[model samples]
Target: GIFGARPYKTFYVENDQVTFATLDPNFKEAVKLSADWYKKGLIDKEVFTRGWGARDAVLPTNMGGMTLDWFGSTASYNSLSTGQIPGFEFYPMEPIQIKDGVKSVTVGRNTTPEIGWGISAASKNPEQAIKFMDWWFSEEGRRTWNFGIEGKHYTMVDGKPVFTDYVLKNPDGKGPLKVLQEVGAQVSGPGVQQDAEYEFQYSNDIAKQGFEMYMKDGNTKRPLPILKYSPKDIKELDKIMALVNQTTEEYMQKWILGVSDVDADWDTYMSRIQQNGIERAKEIVQQGYNHYNSVK
Candidate 1:
């Protein structure tokens, strides 16, 4: 369960097996904590009653500061507040452990980078397109597209690319990334071969600091090998997850707001899903996990 969070859910993954623990004592504690906050008038008065846009409007007003969003989002919030707030900062903090020497935070995966250029079979300009694609992915072309001209946005220092002082210092009042954006410097995203080094250079100092904090402990779960799922399994998962997600959010909001008592209604909640093919859905996931390990 998350720290004093509403309607917290728990699942343990060990040796590639996944299982939920709604009846766990820790889950009960989290529910009680959330309810206590509501009772004491310490929580958002309209927490469960407002729509997303209205709820989010409170964050900028300092009504709610805590968030579960990632480093990039926190960086955006802090940067966007530059002229709006006085000395606002958000430093990413590592999670605290319930027990010493035990890690509790779950690690997730970033999309794997791969060489992905392809010319359309019906293209009239296939030859020219391929030539352009080749140059784009090349080292010299990538450096220029990602960092702009050397001696301008960046320069070579001891054979490694270094951002120039003007770029790093942002002397023109534009943020480092904004300045890079003006010059058509490539920003990493889907289908682009993300140059991690360029992204670090584009980010403001606070974001770079956050990145360092993420790497400081050096203890994180390495990604599992990419596994192919059968088309049948993929379709089944999509159908199951669609219903599961909608149901979970609706039920969770009720429980968190005390409209449904978690202790009294939790078993029925689990039973309802179990009757709706949860076992079969879980079997598919486990099979995929097994295949993932077996291939390597």
Candidate 2:
């Protein structure tokens, strides 16, 4: 509901075809709904004025209300507010259903993480480096990378790696993240990192509940494919979209803040967006997408 009813991106593929979704009908309806919600006081009055730190500034106070955020951080507040405010809690809600019988797709990560290890071409021992990287994905190496050494940071509990008190409940007042950094269990290196129980042990029960809810089948899915465009295509897209994105953000803010009526201003906004080269941007993205699928 922040931008629109439908998930909005510069471009997203639906039915294996690229679409300029910001100008699409579903997003138009979303703009209208945002306007309506703003008028009805469902949205924060200070939404536009507040910077990204709004979460930090607002959430600790009594005035803090609903927010759409990551499951882990969202649940952290419940623990943060524990002694300060009685009965203060935050939990994840299922994505709002805009239309009956249609499930909403929560934008999720690609299976292959964007970050990875790479050996330098000038490396003296490239073969040794390759072997070292390969070891991280192996069974024993995975356990070491994800859980640290046996009987130190973790121990076998019914053939599962369970974090010890050093990582879970630090003797000092350090949080799980800090302890994990010291213990070297949760570093972002090459590995599967399939240790679900690690997150459960670190996070509070509320966060665990939210994690379970979102991880259930059909609750989350990747929204876009990992499409790589040529440098020339990227340069062209960047030029076109810089102006187009500016226009879209301007109109979305205006509509959501009630500075202008969505019904009155939408046509002009669409014209401005098109004049800013949305069509050309779509064409470039489509070309890249088509090439991506053909190769696949």
Candidate 3:
């Protein structure tokens, strides 16, 4: 959720057994509140009718009050600045934790690596690619990439590396960091070890706060480890998954728009899923989960 926006939180279930999850009370409350909002016309009528239209309209402007967006740190910073919405102040709220909750937040593994330099498998000069990769990971190359030409892009301040005034001021209008990237400065990616201090220096305060929040609230669940299945299984799973997602969207929209009575309609929706082979789908998912757990 956006920093300092609604008191948003996430709950995870072992599989898709949301009904059995300890978070049902909170979820029920949230759904009721949303329904109330719809009835009160506080939320847009087309919010559920049209996919993403409400979001597209609401997210870009300072509507109702100062817009609070649930977006990536980089995107949020860029929007506030580059999008020219001034007087925008960003403050990161402490990650909310449910007291006596059944589960704490799970932090996920398999984070996307920072950009890495990879040679094209079809490259003619495979040897050169190998050499470049080797050099890029070396200490000398890292220093050159991060610090830049000694006295130009950065200088040591209190024995710590700092961006030079020239870079900070963006005298050339290209921005020092942009210029460096354009010139193929750093080798970033999954395999690369970035200097944390260097990154901290360039990152905005809000971004830093967001990062901290992520560390605090992020999930610890690694991506489900599953292998490729038979083509028939793959096709069957895809069809069933698509149907489940479609059903979810339909019911969620209906519930949010006050078009469906939650107490009654929810049960009907669940029944429909059961009739549509939800148990079989759950079995497939469980198999995949089992495969992942076994591999890990």
Using TM-score as the measure, the top candidate is 2
Q: Which stretches of candidate 2 lie over 4 Å from their true place?
A: 1-7, 101-103, 113-201
Best by lDDT: 2
Q: Residues 7-110, candidate 3: write the lDDT tens digits.
A: 22222334533121212455444566678877987666666454523433544454423223332323233434454467655554544454444233333434
For model 2, which pairs clash?
none
Candidate 1 per-residue lDDT over residues 141-226, each given as its tens digit: 77877677788899898887888867666665444565576777754442455567766655666767767765755434444444
- Residue 195 deviation, candidate 1, in Å? 3.6
Judge candidate 1 at residue 256 and give its lDDT.
73
User: Which regions in candidate 1 have their CA more than 4 angstroms from the true location?
Assistant: 1-12, 20-59, 76-83, 99-106, 111-193, 216-225
lDDT of 3 at 163: 73
lDDT of 3: 0.54
TM-score of each: 0.62, 0.70, 0.53
